[model samples]
Target: MESNLKWLRSCDLLIQNAYVFESALCRFVQKDVAVKDGLIVDVDKALALDSQKTLDGSGKYLIPGLVDIHMHIESSMTWPGAFYKQALRWGTTTLVADPHEIANVAGLEGIHEMISNALSLDIFFGIPSSVPSTREDLETTGGILDEGEVSELLKDPHMRCLGEVMNFNDLKQEDSKTRRLIQLCKQMRPDFLIEGHCPKLTGQDLSIYLAAGVDADHTHQTPASILEKAAKGMFLEIQDKSVTLENVQTLVTHALYDHFCFVTDDCMADKLYAKGHLNEVVKKAMAYGMPQTQAIYCATYTPARRMHLDDRGMIAPGKKADLVLLRDIASWQIEAVFKDGKPIASYPIPEASFSLSLYHSIHLDPLTEEIFQLHGYQGKAVQANVMVIEPHSTFTHRVIESIPIINGQIAYEKVGLNLVMVFERYGKNGQHAFGFVRNALQSSAALATSWAHDHHNLMVMGNDAKKMCKIANQVIACQGGYGIVDDHGQAMVHLPVGGIISDGPLAVTASELEEVTRRMRQAGYVHDHPIMSFATLSLPVSPELKITDAGLIDCRRQQIIPCIERVLTDEDND
Candidate 1:
């Protein structure tokens, strides 16, 4: 095998007969080019540099490789290789991924898997910071990562900066551990790029957040929100997760596009293979009235600069030579992709390994039949507790005390009942939190996942504690999976992707999710889509109310409260 560095001394191939976007608005054309090894040593009109191969790109458009500032590899349901294969098909050459979901489920081992996967691939790694997310008492997690644990993880070359700091509430309220984390990262990398996760912050609070040296955000839910933060100098990561073409339109017309870049925070696998990655985002921007050049720059230079990735994201000499050729500016379809100046056949698989331990389960022991047994039904119906899902956001609606009970038990409106259970998956006992849910659940035997965001603990909610117990136990039974049991007491569906993702394709998972949705609707769930989002809304770290293994958490107050009222229900309120 020839060394790429040795090949750099002589040109291997070049193409110069194509239009190229040199800068935001400049367009230049050349007749011949030179690629030595895997680097573009020289590009010129005259064929001056010696080359081994040459190609005519008469009608193509050349541009720098597209970079994704923030994304999760697991969301695609495919491993990192599939992510790169699909991403490269659309001209995405690099990415920055947060393995928080995996970290919540697997802890240090999870971090190791992410590090390995990232090393195997040609992407960047933003080290995960908030491993368990909220405080331990607020919820259950598969694992936790403190400063000491994370500092060791950051030593890898692929580990660039701290992952998204999702616990802004903890940092803002002056939690010592949270404060220590910030200080530690700062001390280690004085100029490190710390990602922010302040969703819907405003005024003085936003000011304080910025003052804390937070750098970027992908949580802008509105155009005004983007403008507000951009004016304050925060790099806004324009996203396609919740934002559609309509939202992109509002952004390009209303806000300054320069401060914003493109990101697909949670695009499913089908979307990547079908539509594209950052390249699709650029087309979406142009369709919304953004100039072609500006859209490309936002996808390339803007995010690259924000991430401080100097060697990539541009078409300059003495760089890594990652480049993309486009069919045109309007469509933005990728013609070819190059990594290190060589046309890559496919995306490389990331350095990753399958690992499972006590950290993978919210509870080590499965929920036993005794724990989920029901005594009898009572006629004294009253209000219970509930967790609400926020639309188009990572945050959840707070855990509220406004739920209805039926026959002396909590019921979800006339749909069925709301039941919640927590399993101790960390190989410990006597500290597990369990309780009831009302209103939010939409089915009779339907159970939802407790990844409950940030924390990877198992918080299964259903109308039947036995069924919830079965679902919770199934997680242990299968190592990791979201489960739903029919009223007939059968395991209806299971998704076992690292306990958080499903190895099944997205469509199959979506179908299984649909089955869960159908059961919920049949039993009386009244939500627009399936209550899958309800699983995330149950997170205690975000806003509103949420339930953890510890108990019901008031996100606004950052504290846990009793699942049941201390006094008589109806009489007490009266």
Candidate 2:
């Protein structure tokens, strides 16, 4: 080893005994990688060089550290630091987080708060392009992200790209604040990505969405739409639900693999820990006939490129020495992870310090069981717009359900029907909305969550008004969190941080959620993740129809409509 060597071969770390995937193509070859001061100095011929530290790769195959280009850290319901603790162990070195969930409540300040919390990890941000997501009038969000705030936030180096451009219809309508924000982001980071959430959009509508410079969509997709989107030069950000065996085969078989990337856009803590992060996506892809190498490529280089992060996605000379070592590419067992040329070491998860305002996020007046009551005016049979949940998907189906008003109220005491209610927890107004969710739960259980999509409103669902009130009040009592009330008394997971992410260790939070799920299931609540069944009920963007704090939105029409068709008789009117 010579100090004055031209290539600086006297490195800080040298990783030997390995086969490295050189690029996005995940080509494997025998190589000795050299790292100097957190950056790779040479790939080959460094075998004989002396270094301060060395990691014997043994029988492992080295791949670039996984990069998840699209996700909302809040969705995991864990603090960002806790997320890093788990995700890093599963081979994720970098994350392109969208803090839009918190931003919806606290605006730019919320984004900054998330940034401050994640100061220790490899976290980049996509400025929440659609904070309120869409029409603020419909959803009572506490803060707003207009052009000015977004432009100011874009100045931060961490703002790698714009967050999900949710309002696809606005792009075609050529109106609203979203237009100016998109233009500003385009001007700011012309080459960076603009993520999207356009599901069921095709042909002209898809073209229109792409034309607005929104380059990717992470929503659920079918084979036809995936092919169409890829054909239009748009990147497909696939998640767990969207990555089916058929879709995976179509993407790899057509050689459209490079245009696709894997993302855990909204994984819960249990899912994040129990199931691997991007590693799970890679395994699922491989099981679907995708070669292991291509799966690795989609998880690493493709997402890095989409986020304009070219410096760290490859194990090449002059690249950042962030990498993942696996015992075998087939089994996908993570042996070790290294960031900045140092092996990841297990330690206690770091706690996030926040300002006073963030400690108690939910602000609302008390509510009685009366608020959950639904009635057809004058006690008449009416045709009502009911929210119908498709199995295993967040997308809701709008159905014209018939309601027979009994006595003075229209109640859903039936087995398959449940009362769905949303309260504006931000206290923007005392206004709340009520509707019936049919076929959501099989056992008629009451579950309440303050984790409603972009806007974290308080929501409760069940056939039991007393139980619904109990759950909702329990969630409120926790300051802001999730709660379920059944024969088991009450179970709540406290997420004091914005009422979305729990401020506890990932393990604790994951375990608690698992317990809550088990109890809810035991209580006869039959749905995949009953909490999400209520949580996503208020998201304005997901397909078909969705409910907001204002009322039931005909998502396609992008407006509030009466849940029931009020048929009035002359005698009843008088």
Model 2, clash count? 3
Candidate 1, which ten residues in sequence have the lowest lDDT sum? 374-383
TM-score of 2: 0.95
lDDT of 2 at 155: 82
lDDT of 1 by residue, 62-156 (tens): 88888997988765544565577668767888888888877777777876766565565677877777776777766656678898877786666
Leading candidate by lDDT? 2
Q: What TM-score does each of the candidates earn?
A: 0.84, 0.95
Q: List, residue by residue over 75-156, the lDDT tens digit for candidate 2.
A: 8898889898889888999999989999987888888889998877789998888878878787988778888898788788
lDDT of each prediction vs. the true structure?
Answer: 0.65, 0.81
The number of the candidate with the highest TM-score is 2
Number of backbone collisions per candidate: 21, 3
Q: Which stretches of candidate 2 lie over 4 Å from their true place?
A: 346-350, 375-377, 523-525, 567-574
Q: Any idea what lDDT model 1 has?
A: 0.65
